[model samples]
Target: MPDPFSLSVIVPVWREAPGIESSLKALASIREAGHQVIVVDAGSDDGTAVLAGPLCDRVLVSERGRGAQMNAGAAAAGGNLLLFLHADTRLPADAVTQLETFMTSRSAWGRFDVRLSGRRALFRVIAWFMNQRSRLTGVCTGDQAMFVRRDAFEALGGFRAQPLMEDVEFSRRLCLVSRPYCIHSPVITDSRRWEKLGPWRTIFLMWRLRWRYWRGESPESLAQAYRSDVRNA
Candidate 1:
């Protein structure tokens, strides 16, 4: 018999009331499949928690940070597999079937390919590079919808508290355990940030940040720079 397993998708959000309901509603099929969906709210006063409550298995309150919030959700997750998804990203239609195959694979962690929800040609170009880079480096961003086996995640102690590049940091450590099983089906991620900053500017900004991070810059300083860049834009 195949190894029976369950999945828990943990989404961390803050003040995302406008889109929380829609995001959670998309996961209703997973919930009906006996999987779990947990939403972690970082004290969103915008009723984000309230909007997400009925849609998920649990709505948890946690410290204000993506890494911290995800850690809290992971702590409460009961499934053998855990998926850390972004609020503005939507998984592929066959995500559950893809994951079932992953559960039987020897790989301990994986991530989906990503596409931006923008009509621009540049958006496709950007996603192409993002996926290609991840494939070559064995590192992934949160937009890719990172997932891992529960035991593997626990052994690594989950995500560390960081203001930025938490996903990058975690992916680095995760790569040391086992290379990720790259899923070809893409997740559609919101392109609002890119469109807000202009695609070219956003691309350059990300390249600069990742270069700085590779050069041993502190995440706090990088985070401050990111906020400044976004604010100035």
Candidate 2:
């Protein structure tokens, strides 16, 4: 097998020019530690690819949809480990090393840590919810930046291209065999959506959706609830 440290960080970007740069910056730092970063563009006409320029090891444009873009990007990546990241989220420092420690030993298939932003107070409750859910279900959102062994990823198949909870579904599939890692170091995610929708209200919406999911509501239904609740920019 190739070295476990041979990892590829994949980011699926749409029309997100503002935050993609931050993600690129963090990925650059990860590259400094010896890892490849691939930006998968989903019809991004807003110069998102242009900004990515030299920061990424590869930038491949794909059809719209996060799952499709990610699959296309991962197909072209040479890394043994595949990390799926969001355009608006930042990766943790030493994430590659942390991942190496886990994958080298085959500790767990893969998982993301908690999600946070600069403001600890604002994210305290959010962190609790995310960490608790991850611990219990072995699931992590896209912001947590999920990684998987390349073979396992292909075996389990990639994301579902669903409007909502594709990450959740992917995690569920991953947990069918064993738990994924919930790394100690968390990644910071932009709180702009929460800020626009009111953190408490946003939390409530997510809770409601999760509850509905637990109650057998479909992921599409859950996504529908949030679709009207917040502005997706």
Best by TM-score: 1
Q: In candidate 1, which residue pairs clash?
A: none
Error of 1 at 203 (Å): 0.6
Q: Once superposed on the true structure, which residue ranges of model 2 sit more than 4 Å away at CA? A: 1-4, 118-120
Alpha-carbon TM-score of each model against the true structure: 0.98, 0.90
User: Candidate 2 — which pairs collide?
Assistant: none
Error of 1 at 80 (Å): 0.5
Give the worst 10-residue stretch by lDDT in candidate 1: 1-10
Q: Give the TM-score of candidate 1.
A: 0.98
Estimate candidate 2's alpha-carbon lDDT, on a 0 to 1 scale: 0.79
User: Roughly what TM-score does model 2 have, to 2 decimal places?
Assistant: 0.90
Worst 10 residues of 2 by lDDT: 104-113
Candidate 2 residues 1-233, lDDT tens each?
55546888899989888877877887777788777899999878899999987889998998877778888988999988888888777777777778878775654376656666647487777877787878887877787888888888888877777777777778888887567866778777777777777788978888888778778888777777777777552
lDDT of 1 by residue, 1-233 (tens): 85478999999999999999999999999999999999999999999999998999999999999999999999999999999999999999999999999988899899999999999998999999999999999998999999999999999999989999999999999999999998899999999999999999999999999999999999999999999999999
